[model samples]
Target: MPHDIHIVTEAELRDIVTLDLALVDVIERAFAALSEGGVVMPPVLSMDLPQANGEVDVKTAFIPGVESFAIKVSPGFFDNPKIGLPSLNGLMILFSAKTGLVEAVFLDNGYLTDLRTAAAGAVAARQLAPAQVETAGVIGAGVQARLQIEAAHLVRPFSRVLVHARDAEKARACAADLGQRLGVEAEAVADPAALVAKSQLVVTTTPAREPVLMADWLHPGLHITAMGSDQEGKCEIEPAALSRADVYVCDRGSQCAERGELRAALAAGLWDRGTPPELGDVILGRATGRQSESDVTICDLTGTGVQDTAIAAHVRARFPGAGTVIRA
Candidate 1:
């Protein structure tokens, strides 16, 4: 007999969970599973709707350790701002790898996306960030940027947070929100350069098509997470910035090279697909991160399918009794 399908909502998983802690948890288990060599997650197939400026992505991941399989459908409406809607939306489905049975569904499209992306940041910090990174800086005062600050706080107990945005008032507001939430003072910087100067760890989570953080602003003993610009023609950090870093890492360097920050670096001849370690390799202990305190490290995250699978499983366990399940 065939069992019915289950659906879960974003509101049920969590409310205002900080990006750092949840992100770290997702990365730890995901990488550990990857290290064991039984997980296989190919690149996701995605398309964008021009008229709506929305994105639709499909991803599948296989994890043998948990005997689980998952697929996700997510969309992002960049024009949602003008439409007075949110910029992201999506859902996740977890299945039984053993019998190929669908098990749980997560209905929050953008929420899971943000959680996994932030978790990637925490994962990067655990392996690549400097030993004494007490200050954190975030560019783009959007929701993702706010979570970045919180996630880093979980990995490292930072004393100060610096935030920069296209709008001064928005940046200040974001900073104020973080300060109030974390009980740590967040300073709103006038520009990216100022935030980059004082903070050893920087996270960029904007939707800019051009570069936001410049190369000259970076210094040694610094680690950066570029979370925005996951698609083609989208870039947040300049190519020169990657060139300045001694180590460069990403969830998938090939995809990132084709679309994300890696694309810009390859174009400027600063680096290419042949360079840097995949974040999975580093987490698996197959590659080294931060050879010394003076070296610069960069983690460019374009997201992967495995993340969607893991988060779907997490959310499903919590919301099993709440969602509707009906046989098709």
Candidate 2:
């Protein structure tokens, strides 16, 4: 028998899904399921096109008892902005867990990815950040940078935000925009070290192959979430910083060792691949996180397949019947 496959456009999704505590809760539960040990998530399949300054990653997961799963294809072309195009875009194919049949196609064009990634940052902050955060700092002036600040605010309620980037103009623009939109005191900082010195919460959102954050800048009561280093050869934080952290966590230890900030740390002999606790483990009480308010914490997020599946399932539950549907 043929079944109907719904096609939900990005506009439709934008109208319904948003970055809120509710969405963060959904992603949080997904991470819990991941740590609880029944979800089957595979390693990310990635392809790099150095000539075009681009990369693509395919990720998916199957959590037992979830009605649907999602396979997401995400492409990042760093040079696209030169042509007035966004650097990241992709879609998700939702399938039935029982029959392995296509149920819907989400033409989110990277919105869902941005949402889930930012939500994960919030989870990290909520779990490890100090009791009070007056200022937040973000390294990078891109989409993720802005969203990360917003996400961190949801959990920590910081009153000020600092933006740092290689491009000073873009950094100022991002800061100004965020200040107006978030109704907070936002400014562009020329020095990442200065930003880190003042902020209780910091998020690294760049795709730099070199370190943008150094180890010595870390201070007590600070929590850093490095979400940019999600690919091989990409790094944002100094390797020694991981060793300096009082509590070091990652979305997945193995994945981080392969593609995130931990990869560089592992190569430098500063960390043991199996030593770091995963974010889900801390959330599930399987591991400790931030034993003291003054502890310096770091969270390496390489993005996760279970997050895609969880967000996709959430969308499927609320998908309006207005999208185009075709029988397959």
Question: Each candidate's TM vs. the true structure?
Answer: 0.92, 0.96
lDDT of 1 by residue, 1-328 (tens): 8687876567765553335465567667886676567788777788878898788888788877665677878787888889787777777778887888888776775687787778888888878898887789999998888887877777877888999999999999999998988788789999789789898999999988888999888898889999897788999998888867888887776678877898988887888437667887887778877899988999998887777777666555544565677675
Query: What TM-score does prediction 1 earn?
Result: 0.92
Alpha carbon lDDT at 66, candidate 1: 63
| Per-candidate total of colliding backbone pairs | 3, 0
Candidate 2 to truth, TM? 0.96
Q: Name the Cα RMSD for model 1.
A: 2.2
* lDDT of residue 231 for candidate 1: 83
Estimate the lDDT of model 1: 0.80
lDDT of 2 by residue, 1-328 (tens): 8999999989988898888998899899999999998899988998988998998999999988789999999998999999999988999999999999999999999999999999999999999999799999999999999999999899899889999999999999999988998899999999999999999999999989999999999999999999999888999999999988999999998899999999999999988535789999999999999988899999999999999998889888866463689898
Native-referenced Cα lDDT, model 2: 0.92
